[model samples]
Target: MSGTKPPSALSSVKITFLGTASAQPSSTRNHSSLALHLGGDVWLFDCGEATQHRLQKSSVKMGKIQKIFITHTHGDHIFGLLPLLASRLNGSGGTAEGVEDPRLHVSTGENTQPLEIYGPLGTRAYVRNGLMYTHTLLGAPYVVHELRFPTDPLGDFTTLPRNAAELPTGRNIDQIDGHWPDVFADNLVTVSAAPILHSVPCVGYVVNERPVPGKMDPKEYIPAIKRTKTPMSVMSRLQQGEDVELADGTILRGPPRRHGRKIVILGDTYDPSPIAPIAMDADILIHEATNAHLPGIDPTTKEEDTYETVEMKARSHGHSTPQMAGAFAKRIGTKRLFLNHFSARYAGDDDVNAETAEVMNAIGSLAAGEYGGEVTCSRDLMSIDIQLPK
Candidate 1:
């Protein structure tokens, strides 16, 4: 549980933190950007300056970023979107405006998946107006869906998994089911989005594991013991979640199953209360701590104006502090609270040696420590690998 490495590019579901600094840039950290590696593509969360450059520095292929989800339109949140899109299009044999792929590398797969972009109301303006004069065009093999909404649904799973399937499969809306959204799955991970309270319109994302029920172990099955037609018939029943009806009127039962791990990353938020249910018992919680203080509007006393004491700067701006981050992690019962968007507090000092203690006093270490969880500050190009807890 303590020793795990980030998955390689060949992995089906993985996440990489491209940049973890806050609004300002420093030597140790950049801004806020994360790459979600699923199926064969990387879905970007936020694009700060040098985001595409960071992608090149890591193992993520620029071609794999088929989708990009922006939380808000702040310069810290979106400065790199135009540049990254341009580089990707420039590299893919096209100018940057929209996607247009003449030739694609396709295996003997059952489906063709298109690229998609989802963001706040001004997303089209950023693409059509701001980047339109850049002489860049998209040349992918499939469709390029660009959507802009006034408000994002906060912490809702009903539409997220379904949309991820649809944008790739070209399935009709009537056929899409909120109950299950794997209709267009291509060996990819499931991603869900919800709205969070920030200074602007922001959304948080949760990436879940869709079971490869197709790859379950066959050696432990009773059907492998039997011969002839009955054995094959029994195997089908087990996979389909059906009870085996025996010739002698006896039945063989199937056991219930457990779920894989989940990772939640809230781009930048003011209301973490809604995240409790979404991140309940999550393996890891990687949240942005932009503001270091809690938020409140009080006229009576100093304590009335604050909700958290994780940082001092958050008192004026709406951001999270290390202490506030710990409170949210404790409430959600996460395995670990990886604090990114670090201020200049650590200042090149090793957190394992000094920063951890500062954070414990700033926020309560007892909160995160109760469940064997910890607070690890993110550094530039640092990789945290999550594996199944043993």
Candidate 2:
């Protein structure tokens, strides 16, 4: 399977931080959302409030979103889901000025495939009820797959009473060795999930791309092929791991395969060690750091603001400090650590205030203390590209 496509077909993976705030959004941050761009398709991690608005500002296209994975149903994490789905239903057409108003346009010749949404147990009910109560007749069909746990209550899996837009069935989430089943997969990538320690039944995701064919050395093969009078079609077959017999009856072998990149994205959690096995040796890890304490930089040196105190408080609320996020990245042997889900009190990296810049630096310093990898404190609209290893 790895040698099916040429190495040039390998898509570049990029992550855009749509929102980086924790529970409450500050002026600089919106909420908890991330847009992962793989090839031409987009996979949204969490759809917090104004996620659609954020998409408008980002390079991610609303029509290109193929799937949405909700970690948990926290309001800040999922408030914008309904609106985003509704927008997808509405066609891109609008007034001559190209301004889109949902009320004005229902469906204007827009053809879209069914959107797939994956989330915790209550997700189906929440989406169905929200659409039904709002009287939103979608222009396109959608399906919601709930990842149910054993402790969750058993309920009727029915579509909305009046609306038949939702598909009846969804995938079930069963556990095995601390990992849930593979959430999704295609020729491009495979996505797996694991239950992480959070205030609610939250899950973390790992996206692993399929390996690609190694680069064929034109210098080495072209000379031999020309001498044998081999057709160009033989080169394509050889690149696909097929032994090809040339015009002179000479056999040519394909190049070795190269491993694809791995990306790990987690929701808010105090401890995410359960996913370490699957997340091992990831190229990039996006972990949440809702709170942190820096002794010298922080003005509040009070007893309650000590490192121990702040860490305890953060863990009690099912959150993590920068140190905790970094530790988890180290545990999983991630090459790059990106800290997100910051408290509103800390200004973003874009802020011009010296004090806030110091705070952000302190946060990165704290995480760097635990993890020796490249640490980046993510801000709203920040984009990072992950290229395949040469």
Candidate 3:
């Protein structure tokens, strides 16, 4: 059996929930957004309204954000994208060659690389039009990539006005299983997306970390090398899984590699089971629980409000209850489940009232009933460190 390892271990990954509200924003909760801090870079899941403002309140650094992934083009899911991109531009003494507008003087000199943005169909048009209408000057370059399904409406890509700084591209989603092709890949992690059931074309992401090398004890190998009068360079070869032949004619084998952690984050969806194949055995699953049935503890629940009725209502609105989140987690064999994207009717974790605590507890309980693993009701600015097996 594996145990929870600390963040200091190899390939540390942490998840910070910036906003947890469904469609509406309360005083305590913002819209739907989360940040994944992977090593030096931060990858954003969704950027809703006031997402940049929420980032200021959290520990995540805005400058470290390298990529932004949008689940859908809903207002609650992507309204803040333009503002966030504009914020990245800083004033650097310069102006456009053909135009002399002061607002267009912002420079991308400080930016090291172009920020990559990925989303469903229409994301390219949305970002391009938003920037064009607002006359927003980006200090850095940005590229938008759209994942289109067969059912999505087609657009004339050649007709759209093009800007040199904004590089837009589109690709078709896999027809066989509704999987997205060429999502993203880096030295540390590989990200993939799959279409889920929703009113709009929404996607659920699976982030799989690259396998890390096993720990090698210096005490075990250093002393042995000294006694054999072997060069220290042999240790590097052995650590790379090479059988090193020392002066003593003894072969030293490297430790076995350790499997990396997997994380699944879904957008607002009534059913997300389509992503089960890629999300199997995830270390943590973050699923939306827009509405739930708390029975006696719920203030909004009436005598007629039963589990079946509540679930049906939630599904009708293209949302999910806590039970549905739990069932999906169980199906994917997730070790831990975090419920997010709560309805505006429920008080948030910041609320000091008793009802707030009871509602949060009830949400966790509902999910735990279906999934035997640990369950937590996520709140705005909540940061969770992903633990690894021993």
Candidate 4:
């Protein structure tokens, strides 16, 4: 079999919600974990408590998870890391296969690849303690990158560290670019992170696919090369948007490729303003909506929520309300916004569906009505296929 394969359609980015609960897990919603499906590989964000079990129930492939991005050091956001890593180190349980993509099976033994974790400065210590206490061993090698924001009291996270402190050795990861701090990059996509406002140090991530090569008209080239009998291998180069030399010394130029999709996924945050600029015009924005209104406070009542009331209720907790999340989405102008990290109170009495709908309607009514974008609530195991530009 040929090892070389044609480039995939990177335009299609799928997001799978593994766990979407806030600090406490409700009857239905688990702790927060989201999987970004980029072709065959999966990029996970915010593996909260019981996330490994959530992954076990979902279609997300544990073996194919190339990178794990932690928003902060909060237990609700990161308590599940060590166990998940241990599961990966050992293999997918007894013939357990991928639910969505059947081709994705647990590749054990020699098939394992290096798993990388990206998070704030204290992440190294957090993971180290988890491993030490649990006494977990790993078959697949892993690396941790700790991103630190400026410590100056006056300075917010406007300026972020270019490179993270690589774990074990506590050295910095080699910088890929002078201007943009590159966290990870492959032929399919590039991942980058920036600091966002939360009670703790939180990082928001952006994943962008590489440019796709433009289509080549075989009808135009085939007839012209009929007399010369050009090989199919040479034609492959032309299809890849490369300039090809014909037997008659004529150069066949290929068209410029199209740009792929751009997505932004943020962690738990009270303030979304810091991430708004970075998420500007994104194809999709996954932001936390930890506050929907105190239970029994009817989400539709605008009169009840005076500025002081909301600030005193939600802001002090380092969490964003549906209104705050919506306003932020409006300001950022993301094409689509997904409200995640629901506070357990929203799902009062185990009516998660009704509560989620109420929250979505409340947020959608606020942001999408005024901002001209789409707003939807995310639930565990819900998958959204991102529609990209042509």
Candidate 5:
């Protein structure tokens, strides 16, 4: 599972990792950034430094990003926000030579739909200050949504779900269902957020697609079609689960549809336990593995910190290790786990390779042997296609 090639972008939910490094940048890995291809729209998560440059290297168009979700106000996570916004507003993401470059704009003319940015309390302040300090003139439409817990940090949290139907019911809240922040949702998909323990206020996101309609049994319909001589035009309606009356007054019913895909994307966090329930049965879990050691392992026992033992630094920094990510995915019962947000020390050196090998093997073994799932170490520009349940 660690090195398996991802499927094509045609899948219903395609996740592309743009930046897999943590606060520090390595030659090969940039900061933290991820792109979620939902239908034709693109949603970004944690746009780190040089994320626009990272986007230029990927197939995703920056202009197509409708919403940007920031996990927290950490510099590594939100540093690229201002520049990315400026590019979109000034049309700098457009092609200068009219060539088919990945950096070129996919949309032409003025964008009518305002780009919506969602994040915790400090997000609006950070964006506003960055724009003011940089003296950048914004010409494109945009909006910022600040998320907050309704009562407590673990209580009802605010989000901008595309549809009202996606909101959790009052009964569910009363039952103290895992606090899933209602994020943006649409007719086909629902995105939720949840708080995770970190040095600052941080949140994780989940994208769940609606179940698709089941295919009609042609054999069952064929008999009715022969008996009633039903018109071929009504076949489409019958398959859509509509009770269609045939030419001879025969009624045909459709079957229940299948469930859709579910994906969970997290930010830089130390304790991801709060998201366990919300991530239950998720198709994919994108989590941070900033260290190579297991959870609770202190890499700082020695007076001087070395590359060989950095787990202690991760613990002090409120970040998770590969084992922690694997363990969390297993507890949540997710099918696939992608570990990212790796420290720069593990970028492309022999020491890092050895460390990564050890970490990956440990994650895979633990996920399968203990947690009943699979784990993969994420890399820059890695594309994973999330297929709908068969």
Candidate 6:
């Protein structure tokens, strides 16, 4: 059990889609809630309506989720936050003894961790409102950290006073670098952000972590666990970041493990130039594609929609069509592209599959045709294990 090394590549993370619906929740598409599976804990990005219900259906450890990262404060995205947090807090504190990773279904035999939430504006008010009502057993009290955009007329994600009236506080948690600049740098990952044309202040996030190379010198732990009978729980802490100590206080220091950085959900934006670093030759880019540019009516001829699609027509209202999302991904030189946050106009309708395929093909073609990247659509509960390019 002594002198054991750990695996490189930060824990394998999976983005589980609880719901990918836009505003309206349907039988097919719920609102937007994607679980970022970081081995033990789950980080939820944008908990749309009924995201908690979706969590029950998926293998995502809802109890492990306390942190949430919301893209914007749209009703569709924030409404579910109340119920999901309440249910997770009230129903289950930890996980059941059964729950394995199908990487999809929650199995019982394996070990899992708790959850946390992070997001942009209104997160504090939003979380506070939810907690105010529910009876949650949050020893950590499901922390909430609000990230505001800075400098521009919009909100500031960085550079704010602790005493500012509008400023929000982190729950139970002590330190957090919500500063958009430090979002990736401190993690040793390069991250960037900028404002987009949303109704209110909406910003996008891009992250790229450094990759781990070769294995290290700690492969001898299997025998140690058997010999010393150190609980896997205690051992995992040692591996993750903490030191292991015996009843008599024998300290086993955990060294830094190697891990590769990844680009995450490139989320909804009326625009996309700000998050290039996250897309910087990213192996994957998950951008929103709520518009598909169907052409029965000529845009030039139609005076109203001279500029079609969600991005163009609904510029400041916060939405993007397939073409704009694709072009943005292409411009960022993202190696892979995923389309999510599609409008209700195309969810579970059999007739729309052909249309969906056509839109997918068109957007993929547009991105590949221009940006020279691979493209695909994001399905609910689909787990995509990102592989770094060779």
Give me the candidate number with maximum lDDT.
2
Please, what are the lDDT tens digits per residue for candidate 1 over residues 167-284?
2432221111211122123333565555566777665666666442232355656553353235555665455334565655556553333355577788676566654656677777
Candidate 2 per-residue lDDT, tens place, 1-390, comes to 354454334466899999999999888898899999988889999999999988898888899998999999999999999899889865232345766445442332335356889988878878878787776667667778777776776663555552355654556666676677577877768898988899998989899887776778767678778898776767776665566667777777887767788999999899998888899999999999998887777675465577888999999999999999888888889999999999988778545778878888889889989997789899889998898867
Query: For model 3, how does the per-residue alpha-carbon lDDT over 78-115 read when each residue is reduced to its tens digit?
Result: 99888888886442333567756554533335443678
When 2 and 6 are scored with TM-score, the better candidate is: 2
lDDT for each of the candidates?
Answer: 0.56, 0.82, 0.81, 0.69, 0.71, 0.59
Candidate 6 residues 209-319, lDDT tens each?
555543323554444544566665665655555567654445656555444655646556777665554456666777777655544421322434433433466455567
lDDT of 5 by residue, 59-159 (tens): 98988898898999898999998899888766333344756543222232343466778887767657666665554555555667666655434422333
* Arranged by TM-score, best first: 2, 3, 4, 5, 1, 6
Model 2: lDDT of residue 377: 90
TM-score, one value per model: 0.67, 0.89, 0.89, 0.79, 0.77, 0.67
Stretch of 10 with least lDDT, candidate 5: 164-173
| TM-score between model 3 and native | 0.89
Candidate 1 weakest lDDT stretch, 10 residues: 171-180
Position 156, candidate 6: lDDT:
30
Residues 1-390, model 4: lDDT tens digits: 134443545745799988888989987788989999887788889888888888888888898898888888899989888788878766222233534422123333344455788887667666666655544444446677666555523322223221211223332333232112667777777877776778876778888777776766778877756757777677776666677788988877766667678888888777756555556777788888776543344655466666457656667888877667777777777778888888775552223466556655664565455456778777788888986666
Candidate 6 off by > 4 Å: 1-7, 91-115, 133-140, 151-179, 184-194, 215-259, 296-311, 348-356
**Ten residues in a row with the worst lDDT in model 6?**
160-169
Give the true-structure RMSD of model 1: 9.4
